[model samples]
Target: MPELPEVETVCNAIRKSIKTNKIKEFVIINPKLRWNIDANIKKLLSKVDIRKIYRRGKYIIFNFNHGSLIIHLGMTGIVKFLKNRHKVNKHDHYEIKFQDNTILRYNDVRKFGSIHWAENIEDNFLIKNLGVEPLSDNFNYEYIKKISKKRNVVIKNIIMDQRIVVGIGNIYASEALYMSKIKPNKNCKLLSTDNFKSLVKSIKKVLQKSIKAGGTSIKDFQSIDGSPGYFKQKLLIYGLEKCACGKNIKNIRISGRSSFYCSNCQK
Candidate 1:
């Protein structure tokens, strides 16, 4: 599944093509998704002008006056902009034809992605409960401390929780914990203010680096140009057999997600 950085990359890639463009048509190849698409969505979006494109968590928002279109690239999904007459992949389940003849397509092999129409994006069911953006001012050490109170889960799980901090997925949690020299399985209750402060910094740094590197592409993640993310090459601990400290990196499952850390380095 595409995480925050990947989603942001998509937003950046699609922005120019989508913003201020008039949708000539909404082509629906398959309406079956994780959340079924409304049959009339195509008709509803016809001729709608796109004013902006952005991301909230893993969901992409295509904004216009009085309405917004939300999309989630659940897993194995990618959106691409192609020339008007380009070859279409079989997984191309949704499409938008701009009045200028630019083609935007959403393809998902697993069909787990979704599309939604919302009159108010902030109040949409999917957007309402999402936690603060990891890159925002709201995700400081104080906020982490406030949310960690009485929470017994592992530190990795805590940060990965969308309700606590949005978009720090499994990959980032492992990298951040490793960077901060903290164990991924460390209990949230066992962490001190200093520990939380380190974690907050580490998370922000790791995420920013990944975003700059165009997001980590272990599998099924690519930019709108079909280019795989280059961040995986810079990954420190994830998927590695040994750490820089020359110790074997531990691979443990916390909350059913694999976590990588060097026991010799991370506490």
Candidate 2:
């Protein structure tokens, strides 16, 4: 699945070309995705001018004159802007035609991505519960400390929880834990203030680096321009089971998700 950095990259690329463009039409290739397309969406967005594009967690918000269009790029989903009409692929779920004749295509192999019309993005259920953005001022060490006190979950799971800190997915979580030199299996309550501070810094550093590198291209992720991210080349321990420490890194399952860490370095 595309995480925050990948989503933000798409948002930026789309914003440059699509902002202020009038929506000429919308085509829903898959009927399952048009649950309320006609009644709720068409009435709200047809011919509306796109105001701006922003991201909340992994979702992209296409702001318009009346309501905003919220897009979640679930696993195996990609949104691209095409200069001309082309043959639709098997998973092309939605398309938005712009007044300039340029079309934005949404393709999802898993059909898990969604598009919804929202009057106020902040009040929407999906956007309401998301935790603070890692890049925002609200996501400091103190904030992490406050949330860490709520449960005895592993630090890895605690950071992965969207309710505690949004956008820290499995890949980034492993990288951050490794950077902080904290064991991925450490309980949240076992983290001291120093640990929280180091973890918070590592989270920000890892995420910023990934964004700069255009996000990790693991599996099906690609930028709007169909370019694969290069961050994977810089990974320290996420997929390196026989890491450089001469001691093997352990790959364990926690909360049913795979976690990677150097047993020698991350204790």
Candidate 3:
């Protein structure tokens, strides 16, 4: 699945080329995605000028004259711009043709991505309950300590919760915990103030580095320009189960998700 950094990278690329353009036509090739892809999008979006494009967590928000378009790049989804001679491929589910003949194509092999039209996008249920962005001032160490005081769940799971903090996915969560030297299975309530501060810093550092590198491309992730991310090379111990650490870096299952951490360094 595309994480926050990957989604932000795509949003930035698309904003430059598609902003201020008018939507000439909109097409949905996959029916399963049509449910999330608003049926009245064509009617509401026709001729509406795209004013800006931004990202909130993992969703891309395209600001328009009367409304906004929210897009989620689920698993194996990529959005790319096609100039002339734009041809739709097998997984190209959604396309928005601009008056300038530029094409914004949304391709998702898993058919789990979404494109929705919202009159009041910020108030929409899809975005209303999201927690603070990891890079924002709202996610500081003091904020995390307050939230952690009442939670007894594992620190890894707490950070992974979208309600607690947005965009800390499994990979980044594991990476951040390892960097903070906190055991993934440690209870959130037991975390010291120092640990909380370090975790917050690690989350921001790791996410900032990943965004700069255009996100980590573990499986099927690409920027809006169809470029693969380069951050995977900097991973410390997310997938290296056999790395020779003084203590084992065991792979454990937490909340039905795979977690990787060095037993010696973390805890």
* TM-score winner: 1
- Model 2, 2-102: lDDT tens digits are 87788877788788767447888787776455242444575566677877778888889988877788888877779888877598889788788888878
* lDDT winner between candidates 1 and 2: 1
Model 1: residues >4 Å from true position, as ranges?
Answer: 18-20
- Superposed Cα deviation of residue 152, candidate 2 (Å): 1.6
Give the Å shift of residue 100 in candidate 2: 0.6
Q: Tell me how many clashing residue pairs each candidate has.
A: 0, 0, 0
For candidate 2, which ten residues in a row score worst on lDDT?
31-40
lDDT winner: 1
lDDT of 2 at 218: 81
Report RMSD (Å) for each prediction in the order shown.
1.4, 1.8, 1.7
lDDT of 3 by residue, 192-245 (tens): 999999999999999999999999998888887667889899888788765346
Query: Which parts of model 3 have CA positions greater than 4 angstroms off?
Result: 242-246
Give a tens-digit lDDT track for model 1, residues 48-135.
8888788888889988886899999987889998777887678788898888888899999999899999989888998999999999
TM-score: model 1 vs. ground truth = 0.96
* lDDT agreement with native, every candidate: 0.87, 0.84, 0.84
